[model samples]
Target: MLTEVNLAFNNLQGSIPSSIGHCQNLLAMSLSHNNLSGPIPPQAFELPSLSIFLDLKSNYLTGGLPLTVEKLKNLGAFRVSRNRLSGLLPNNLGSCVRLEALFLEGNLFEGPIPSSLSSLRGLVALDVSDNNLSGEVPEFLVSFGALKYLNLSFNDFEGVIPSEGVFKNKSATFVEGNNNLCGGIPELHLSRCNSKTSSDTSLKLKVAIIVVILGVTLVFSCLLILWFRKKKEQPTTTCAENSILQLSYQSILRATDGFSIQNLLGSGSFGSVYKGILEESGAIIAVKVLNLLNRGASRSFLAECEALRNIRHRNLVKVLTAISGVDYRGNDFKALVYEFMEYGSLEEWLHQSINRNESGIMRNLSFFQRVNVAIDVAYALEYLHHHCETTIIHCDLKPSNILLDQEMVGHISDFGLAKILSSDRLNYSTNQSSSIGLRGTIGYAPPEYAMGSELSTKGDVYSYGILLLEIFTGKRPTDNMFKEGLSIHNFVEAALPEQVIEITDPILLQERARQGTFTEFTLNDKHLQHLNSIFEIGLTCSAESPTERMDMSDVVSKLCSIRVKLLHPTRVYRERQALYIAQSAGIQ
Candidate 1:
């Protein structure tokens, strides 16, 4: 009975039984994606022989990481993300010297990153994002040749993010949001140390000169000062904020042919989005015109403005300008002009009707394309959740909310439900009870929302979990489960306890190469296994309770690992594919 215990992504509750430490023969133990609480038992980390992987991520584990973790020298992988643990990282973590991947993100950990981590020469990936770590990032980490991926965003680290050596030009390092950090790559726009020193000296000299001049006082020429002031009268408007950036309403009407259906690309809860070309620039744009302009929508409108004003990520949709003015119809109107996305929403392409007959095949999403799209959204979320000055929670994250550009690149749009959590101070909404009623679409909302509790990043994780399930199964979360008639969560729960293959998408059984989506033209068992693992991961993410969902950073990493495995056409993948095809065809 003491085999590898991987009870991740289930509805299991309560603290881990301390008896688990007695599983002496256990090779890998993953208790991730559960609502398991209490400090991680010191015994779990002090296991003498368990080695392959130890992942306790996406749980409600609290208390600072047990110092006992340093004893697991043979541990190859360690992840403990999205917990409430705080305090400085244990300097002895480097004792797991052979560790290849280490994740401690989404915690309250503060203090300087231990310089001892530089000794993790074998480390390939490290994420300590969304913490309160301060002080200079150890210089040794930058030059530690083995480190391929590093994320230290959403922290209070001081000093410069050294751009020399391995850290140069690597976007993944993501050392943003540390206001005190300076003098990195030009992209960061941090002040150069030398310029700061020079500016300090210049400021002193200017102050001295001003003091000396003031000491020499001018004898009253009140009439002369009044004449100078009258000569220097200022203009009424600043000529910037009030300046009109959008075309006239008449021009927009002409471009859209009086709001014809032919010009409409899509419609959403707020408004109908139309595609149009600007008459002056001949530039194509997507315009979202407010439909009802209800009083309740005022908050959403302001939220969008705040989100747009602050964000500047490449993967995010850009708002060219917002048009709000009185029209000839006498009703005040408003619309947002955005850079057009030719492809449209991922939801439409995945599930919506395609042609007149309704027989048109769902646009086949390629493996590489899916991975790339996931990466794009992950990067955007990373920017919002970790790189921004305050953490942002994207409360609504359905596929319909994710749009694809002309290049088929994905961007997470619609920030109306975003909530900013500032780090400088703790603040909660007075309208907390009122906000409780604003739960997102039912199945996507986490258990906390269903129970009418305050919102948190965990709620977003729950939504993402459902999204992952939809992406892998090609089925909506509401789809009926066979016989048992349970929903997607129930189906995944029942299937995962048995095996991952039971819940895989049936369409994937076809020769993946024949599908013509992948650059390579083949599918095999290894790919099947990889898909199975990813499905299991999705199940883990969508666990009923928010506390059981994995952090987005860990989700991205696990998905990337599967993606890498898929790219490598091993014999295992081929054999699995052959077996899968044979089994589906009823071959003995």
Candidate 2:
């Protein structure tokens, strides 16, 4: 009747016995910090009652990961890190759908991470760092929505580091040591990467030698013909076609009334944002005035202008005009005018900080409001990453960057660190990065940026995940209480489905409780179910491995489905509502 077996730190040696899986009642087993060797037995993962955990870390185990791992459907935690295991991660890991935690760090695992790993819906913590895994990080991790801890550091991961989900929480994740990583949050302090593909020196040398042998005139003619062909194949968008508005400095200044404190909306690293009204037109606008004295302000102004130039989406913040000229004092002045959002940023509604006005009281978002915000953000990102002519990575995605208009419709803003990938690259499974710079805020930037990863669309998905978590929990990733292994991701991941009420914002909890007693029981049930779905989406988007995060396209689809189930309940809920009302009135 033994259900748990603890054999940790016993200095055990030799391979695990094949007959160990015969213990049908064994719910937990530990043989960690030992000197065990050889391949993992197929029966190990097939054990019916190994639902608690199977800790075999800090061992000398070797060989490729066993494909039989799919049998541990009930397993909660699987730790094989700190070992000498080699080969590719088994796609069968997808079958272990109940796995809540996976640790494969410090192994010899190589090649591209399997996309099938996205099936781990309940996964909360994942660490695949210190391995030899190569290729672009998968985007499905963001789909896990339940993930909290992610560590991809010291690996061979290349291309753009994602900025979404757990990537937004710096301390919660570890993505350092891989030099090929680049273009994440500015807080990561990583080096910038060259956006253009680097030409191989050896290839150039070979071409020179061939040109000399083949005759310079003939080679020059061939090169000219190739250039023309490439040019002809390129997609072109005219300035007029883009419909980019051109505004003058005088017009911007007059609109903001000399950039008065009364008109100041918010201030960031680059400049001060002001609410303005055009002189000729009484239309309301939000003007961001760049501080020329600041080192990177000018660059940020240009970056935002470029990112918004050709992109258009209902959920995306619209740029009416960009002004570049000198101020009255002859100082260089640059500004961006955007459609004003009367309800303010999502950050103001979710947190008690930084939305200060004369009332000095903070506001909170309703459950439905938060879901709408998530949907809006997802749609905007999907357009930028998948639907646009040129794929764009919104290197900075946070609640503050998400503005809610008068109708509480969310709009994604702040593209100061956006990276535009070539449209041709989108034809492939994953897009590439051509950017080199520090990106995103400290608490919201992805970890791989510190290690110099490329700017990929998955990065934006990561940020969106963090934003989603913040909206529901009312806690920032950088909150003072979250430290030393405790993070917003872990905190929420620990309290899910049934216990989510424990960590949710008090306002939401109170509202749900109030509504539960009087509202139809099925409606309340559906609300909680909808909430659980959103949590899963947030976890998936914020996963440690970029490949594990869900793509923006998938995110939008999920959010829309949830919205339908919540707002327009099925006939079952309606029938239950009538039944409950009649029963209360003694009319049954």
Tell me, by lDDT, which candidate is best: 2
Mind giving the per-residue lDDT tens digits that candidate 2 earns over 1-588? 778888865557799888887787888888876668888888777786888788887676888877778888888778886677888888888888887777787677888888888888777777787677888777787566766667777676767666777666675556665646776666665557666544564577788898798798887899999767633443112232344344566666688888899999888766778998887767788987777787656555555566567666667777777766556665666777788988888877777666554587445577777777888788788778865567777777888888888768898887343333343533322212333233667777776765667667777788888888888888899999899988777777888878766666766754434433423223267677777778888988888778999987668656765775576533121223322332333321
Candidate 2: regions farther than 4 A off? 1-246, 354-357, 360-362, 415-438, 511-523, 570-588
Badly placed stretches (over 4 Å) of model 1 are 1-248, 352-362, 415-438, 482-485, 497-502, 511-523, 568-588
What is the Å distance of residue 461 in model 1 from its true position?
0.7
* Overall lDDT per candidate, in order of appearance: 0.66, 0.71
Listed in order, each prediction's TM-score against the native is 0.53, 0.52
Question: Per-residue alpha-carbon lDDT of model 1 for 1-588, expressed as tens digits?
Answer: 465778876656788787777777776888876667888888788785766778887676788878887888877678787666778899898788777677787777999988788778877667787788988878888776756567777677877678875577554466755656778788766656555554687798999888867764552366568546533431111112322244556666777877789998777555677888887777787777766465434444444555555555656776666665545665656666677777777777655344122355456566556666766676566567765656766667777778898678888876333333332222435244125234567667777776667666677777777777776666787654433657676666676644655565544444345555634334456766776676677777778776777777667656655654565443121223432332333321
lDDT score at residue 223, model 2, on the 0-100 scale: 94
